[model samples]
Target: MGLLVVKNIGLLLTMSNRLAIADAVVVIKDGVIEWVGPSAEFDLDLYQDCTVIDADGGLVTPGLVECHTHLIFAGGRSDEFEARATGVPYAEIARRGGGIAKTVKATREASEDQLFELAVPRVYSFLAQGVTTVEAKSGYGLDFDSEMRLLNVAARLDKATPVDIVSTFLGAHSIPAEAKENRAAFVDDICDRWIPEVAQRQLAVFCDVFCESIAFSVDESRRILKAGLLAGLKPKIHAEQLARTGGALLAAELGAVSADHLDFASKQDAKALAEAGTVGVLLPGCAVSMCKPDFPDPKLLQAAGVKIALSTDYNPGSSVTLNLPLMGSFAMAFMGMSAMEVWEAITINAAAALDLQDFVGMVKPGYKGDLVIFRGADPVGPFYEYGGSKVAKVIKEGSVVVRRDPCGGVTI
Candidate 1:
């Protein structure tokens, strides 16, 4: 809570164009970064009472931000995963009464306490991999009470965990079985009933929609998002994941914060997003889990001047992993993203996706004192060596919250 100093950093990545620095020092006072520079210029004697942490010549960067995740779900989908392995398409699986609907049943059946307990370990997993902030969506709950419960659990997670949990209202995630006969009526329920209540109760920061062939149409998505905007929630869209349904274009038109899973997004969509200043959040983990080789073209997005961010897309049915570094590896190996791009995706760019750029996701002065110290000198070690934990320490709000020993024992 007082003065804290992290000294002797071998390589520091500040998520700027001039990214890396050597022998760096970061000074924090009362949970905010005060200074960052070379250790030689930092005189420890100038500070009378300060707690110092030796980085041991490790890699230091701002704490990772998971901008898109379904972290509040109540069940797993191991069976559905196996079903997909046998060459069944995701759409076919959904038709067979699986996927999001299955998770919805489980989530709706769960008590708030049960959902909170299930989610705490998942948050811990994110923290273990240097994630200090995550955006959790309430998609599994299609109905109002269930959706409100999910948001409440997310709020509890923010207060209970070391990491910050940003909540999104995703009542337009999927059409429930009860409303399958009257899809338009259900859409009305979302816009007219759910969104206003969510806004009035201040339950969520963003309103998101899954705009796809399997979910809501472009027009329906627009209606829901417009209602959210009218009720004071910012817009985010799950766009073009399985197919191109004009979701990205809608996101650009609405000036949403982010358009995610742009596997089918065209260069024109990229240009639109760039013009609108919408961050294109790519999810490589989903591609790997679904056995889909196609990934969002980072080069095309960059060429169009679209800011690209990356996320784990951690969910029950697909992309069920908390390792953001593994996602970086996937991005480089499959999506052709550079290590610097991967780092920026998980840090500053991702924070921009969540509209938290000024608060977190940078090592500069006045940002939150949240950082990760890896076990090696190379800042790209996590992406280079994909599987294992390279994190040695994680600092949140000027305090060391996680420490991993040489033998791989973790203290949190």
Candidate 2:
């Protein structure tokens, strides 16, 4: 946490209005960026003993932020994945006890220690891809006890790893099979028992509900989100992924932080989100893996002045990959986002989606010293590459956390 300086950055994409800069110098002190600008403008004699890192004329940018992920589950959903590939509907699969329900059973059957062990590598995988911060959700465990265990595992992972984990209580990810018949009572339990408990224990910073036709309805999502807001926890929603169901409008009305997976959101919804100052987070990984590429109209959202963010939605069944670069590729190819727009989606806009815009996301002074160096041609070179983003080194809190060999293997 001492003084550290990075000099000779060839292409520094700050994710700011000023955009990329050439030959930049970034001075970090105590794991926080103290100064960043042209290399010529940096004063060398102020702290002669500072550790210096030469960028080797490489492209440097803010470390990626994965704002949406369900990476704290104990089991894989390969069966459900294959079933969906064969044209089985998610609702039908869930009805037959094969979707999230299956994962819930596996998660509940596993011990807290087992869940902790399982989540460690998942966090590492994101870090290996230059993701320094992550929003990991606990949704596979639908019951209160199991949900608490999952969240505790997430918190423990945050302590064990260098990557910052933002834990979310997604107790309304789906109604458990046991509570399917009595939906109202189960919802009441979530509003009364789960929200208060999660808030009191400081178990999660955000509370999320899957608002869709196959999951909680718009009304149910509203009830749960309102309860969380009242309990002093921030609100987020899995909105309009399966169907519109008014989730977008509800999120805007409730003043939620973000509305995600908006494959079916309308232009009106985009306007409402922009008016309400809510971020629109997309999951192109899920679209590419499961559904057709009928994504939320990026042009409508952009024209409406809605801020956009992207995530892997890294889950067992829908989006199995933890590759943020791949999601960027998909965003450009499938979601009609440009290279620069996609970069902001994963970095600055992602931090905004998590309500952490002031801290992480940008390579600016007063922000955390989380940075990524890429072996690429220019600022947008890695993102535009075909196979994968050529990540060279990942620095978090002024420490080199992950490094990639010349042969393309990542080590942390």
- Candidate closest to the true structure, highest lDDT: 1
lDDT of 2 by residue, 269-349 (tens): 999999998999988777656855565557778888989998999998888888998888877877788889988999999
Name the runs in model 2 displaced over 4 angstroms: none
What is the C-alpha lDDT profile of model 1 across 310-395, one tens digit per residue?
99999987798889999899888988898888999999999999999999988999999999999998967899998788999999
Candidate 2 Cα RMSD (Å)? 1.4
Tell me the TM-score of model 2.
0.97
Clashing pairs in 2: none
Per-candidate TM equals: 0.98, 0.97
The local lDDT score (0 to 100) that residue 163 gets in candidate 1 is: 96
- Give the number of the best model, judged by TM-score: 1
State the number of backbone clashes in model 1.
Answer: 0
- Per the 3 Å backbone cut-off, how many clashing residue pairs does candidate 2 have? 0
